[model samples]
Target: MKYDKKEPETMDADPMRLLVSAILAFTVMLFINGFVGSMGGFPAFVAFTLVFFRIRTRAGMGNGGMQQELSDRQITGRLLWKYAAGYLVLWGILRIAFLISRVTGWGNINGASAVEYVRQMWNTSLLEKWAYFFAGMIMFAFVLSLFPLAVIREKVRWIRYALVDGAVFALVCLGNNGVCRLKFEQKSSGGATCLIDHLLLCGRMRTWQEITCLLAMVVFILVIGAFVFSYASRQYAVKNIDGIPASAGEEESRRHRMIRKIVTVGCSIAAIVIVVVIVLLMPKDTAGDYTKVAEFLTEDTRMGPMEYGDVVYVSVNEEADLEKNGIAQGYLAERGERCDSRFYQLAIANLLYTDPTGKTNLVQTAGTDGGTYAPVASVETDKTWETDDVFLLWDEDWALESAYSHEPTGYVACPADLIQGLRMQFPDVTYRTADFSDYDAYFTLRGYQNMEQALEEDPVDGDWVGCILVKDNKFYFGSYENQITGICLQQLRKVLGGNAK
Candidate 1:
């Protein structure tokens, strides 16, 4: 077919493709970088942007003439080899940086975070990190090079592309190879996957509303089919006898026109119904409705095991059934909102538990010896524990026997066992317990004598002590050897829960 001079050589560019590519690339990179312990995520974003532009340009060329004759294997192979070399070269530089850190004691490099592969280092060579970062970008570009090939070879590339895409997509979505392993076998380590597994367990099945929406969608699809079929049938009939013009065919033509008009009216109504049904099928977002910490705690049967160290943490509240408990201690309680420790405990617990629905798994406790620490604001208190029952809290008015040199009101709370353990395991600091009748006495003893004085002191100056809330009760513990954060607390809570706490 010859094209008219007025016709454009190619169709307009599809912005939709670019947008989709960008979103998919970002989501994949974020997940991979978070789980792979590589700083390649940002680079992957860069690679996707470049590839999107390149693809859009190539798309304008269309699959005609010479392009159509090219073999899929040859096209894909050339593209893959070209970008792979670029990516590897970049990765090579990052590898060198990693090797240097392993040998040198100068740079303070922290390993991968829970979410990304990028190592966080303080006082380290920024240039080196950047080198590795760029390498990740190159790798992503190489991966995306095959996107075009997959699209063009859709019929034959199902198995090939599906395998490749599945691996990449799973890794990107789940964060780590561990997750991917669980996805395929449903028995890797334990359970299906980590976060996804727990999410599925917590999430509800399709409700009646969702089912109704799905039914509506089916109806809409059926209507669309019926309308399209009728419209097409009318057009087909007209086309078959469209040119005949005579008295004999005149009556037939009139009859066909009336039928076509009726079909057109029916099609229009069906089209409107389809659109309305589709709109109704869309899902809506809603806010989370979780109870507050204090409220959740006071509820009956809230007691849960929290295994930390060698002992399990049992609830110390009077309401809890404490008949067989061996120890008990009370720590000043902080406001529910200020207690960030419990959230961290939950996050880590999800990571540690192979079966989140209270299944057994043997995971080593990091204990006081194993932890990532950073300076933070906290309280101080001391108490002896004869039983496993423990209570942790922060009193706004609680004061110490001696003032925390840097701050007026700081306290630590733990049962006698933990205090003794801390002393035996980590003996540099002194530990003492304070008994305050109420918040006011607690602050007065700590030297914060007044709330005004407490406000003047820096919150982060002292050793890190904080509350870790399990299912209902709070356990107050102190660490002198390392710092504890909300993240570590969550992991500890999960492990401790295994011991029937």
Candidate 2:
């Protein structure tokens, strides 16, 4: 019997309803895939591939409607290629978005005043961008709504087109979260500035290993699954098509199949090469020291093995600043949680006690105040060693430039008793401060510039004031802008024991 253009009136299933159901099912599947990722152990690539194959197999069987048989001769390489290429492009866009989010604090609503932008985009008001997105999705569905009608009449390629487009739409929706996070960072205080500082001063990326592993897994799974699904769908179709199509339809289908196979082969090779290049380029220096530090810090075992140096100039309270700016707060709000605050005063106090000149009274006042100091000019020393670990620790207000240039280097200040306990532990360590005047001479001789000059002249923040230097038969804190307090000396002594002093 010849197939009719329209279905018989008794047909129970409404094509439009089936189309809506398919769209809704795919959307639900995409949401579930994301939820599975959050639960851990389930790979998104695998989940998506399984969903796609299930759709293809069901479509091939005609959802138990009119039976069809596919032909092996009709399943040309071109069709597989087209299908794979479409999926690959969709995957690429999603990957790029995910990368942006991971690097830039995107979609992390808790980060850097991100909530405002998120709220703006997703608010319930009709004017919100989210409403626009929904409208767009509706228009897209309307235009593609004819896909189910095509599938019902066995115009199989429309089903393929619809699936590819829907998959892309889903991936893009997921990736927009990352893009939103990027928007948040650009708007907030210390957002881009903090990013640039981390780039220049922080030196290396921390999550390189995990990134390499994830990329490797994703590429491997996508390639293997794409090929398997393509070949299986073609075989299933060839087995199922019962009625011969018009000469034109058959010719078109053959040409399409050949193109898809070619695309698949090209895509598989490209995916492999891209994955290899990314893995090879991954950063490998896991624990490289970004700063050079004092002698009292050791590389031995009682404490965890030592990391080489400090990462930046100021150990500012990053968490406090982030919270102030409305960045997402993490476990910090929990009571009694110890924060790894960069105690600059502890280092400053160590410098004070070690200062060769007894007149280094700048260190005494720091003990009474919270571990903060302010910019001070020294009449005794020609110029403050801006990079040294000394700052007036009492000032509630401090800026990044001040700490970078004006502060002196010493132990991060802690309670006085902590110092005494450390001294008792490491009695032999000879921790002492250098003369403030000598620090000026040293910086001049070494061709060093202060923090402000450095920031203005050299954008790299390369011009540091002082370091915990160890020369032949010489061991001492060399920078004098800030004096190392007795408090820091004690902590160092305790850490290094007799050998460090």
Candidate 3:
């Protein structure tokens, strides 16, 4: 009998291809790691492992083009030990860091004393926490670096792969941190500046602790990659012994195959159902509130010849009437002067009169003997206008450079005293102040312009002050440069409810 002989295929050991594949796999894993809680990490890791295996197979890296030439028993034993070790090391590091942070008074765990903090930490189920930590890290390592490390073991030196993998992981960490920082700054600053500028600014402002923590994280990641590579490489080197059969491409029994098929179909159906439920339960956008307010301002006959300057005259009576008018218009007017007038009126009404619970009251008072109303309220000097509910005052300047030109520019300043008084009066209400320059950011964040055009014209130089009222997590803004007088407050109070002392 003649036997046919086939030559074993030699795997392609392209360093660049391996490096790129590792980067892409890890990048995707990082992106999707926290997608659906810790469980999300498992699928991402599995996907990466599969990809790593395919890459190795195509390159003809191991026995029958597999990354590891180990028998089933050897592979299982090695994986269990590596996973256990990785989990223990990572959990220990985290626990140590937590303790150190507490001892140093940096943890700020509800202002607990060091003893209390330690007690609290120890009181929790450490085993359970460690179990979770281990699970996450084991999955992360397997998907992120373990498989890749094993594949490269035969082709490249372990030390070289460790160094290369560690460097790549460190770079990924830095890039991810930079991206997150940029996003946070954008949200805080309302996207006023470019991401590069924000990154540079934030880099300069990072505290020593922050820098240290970042460096430590990078080192930790590097160590993990190195450790995984070292352990996996050793496991792959082990020769098959008696009673330990190869696991790759082994034929399965009919029942086992049938069970596997059923499981796959079940998981697919469950995933589809979860997606459908999530879509159905998604929260409705609150942009419609701003749209409703805009519509009420434009179409309500009670708004009666409203003007940008007339926002000061808005009262509870007009407010109630305006709210009653409901969302009558479909869209806001163009962003010219007319748009500004409508915006101010709508903002004022929304701020003063939208409370459905009647917890707020507007009181009218007599005019101040001698007070001037200006378009912009000056923060250079002490000035106070008493309202029934609170005293409104502005005593200091808060300035910022222009986001567009990077030149010194003015911003609307809210008086600290006024804020304190308002807070005292209505503890539940939230107050935010914004300058004219911040209008775009403020409006965009609030989703105020459902169909309103961007304000193309430069903000009026003297018109700098604005007040934002936050109730039930909803924002309402109103602003005027004109100095508010006792008489003005009285008239506004009369419209609101009654006389102010």
Score residue 253 of candidate 2 by CA lDDT. 72
lDDT of 2 by residue, 362-450 (tens): 21111112111111112113323233332111111123334566653211223334433433443333222323212221111111233
- Candidate order by decreasing lDDT: 3, 1, 2
Q: What does candidate 2 score in Cα RMSD to the true structure?
A: 19.5
Candidate number with the higher lDDT (1 or 2): 1
Q: Candidate 1: misplaced stretches above 4 Å? A: 1-14, 30-40, 59-74, 85-164, 167-501
Angstrom error at residue 89, model 3: 28
Provide TM-scores for the models.
0.27, 0.24, 0.26
Whole-model lDDT per candidate: 0.33, 0.31, 0.35
Worst 10 residues of 2 by lDDT: 299-308
Residue ranges of candidate 3 with Cα displaced over 4 Å: 1-5, 8-32, 35-54, 58-143, 148-207, 239-501
| TM-score of candidate 2 to 2 decimals | 0.24
lDDT of 1: 0.33
The sequence of per-residue lDDT tens digits that candidate 1 reaches over residues 1-501 is 122234223323767656756775675565444333244445556555555445433323322212453443343333434444544454455556655654453432433242222232342233333323332342343254334431232223223332344344343334433423443433322322222332222223345743563465456445433443343223222211111112334556778978866765555555445434433542231111122121111111112122322232222211211212212121111222221222222222212111233222222112111111111111222222222233232343233312445453334333434433433443333221121111111110111223342345532112222332222243323322233335334444443442223
Supply the global lDDT for candidate 2: 0.31
Task: Report residue 183 deviation for candidate 2 (angstroms).
Answer: 41
Please state every model's RMSD to the true fold in angstroms.
Answer: 20.4, 19.5, 20.6
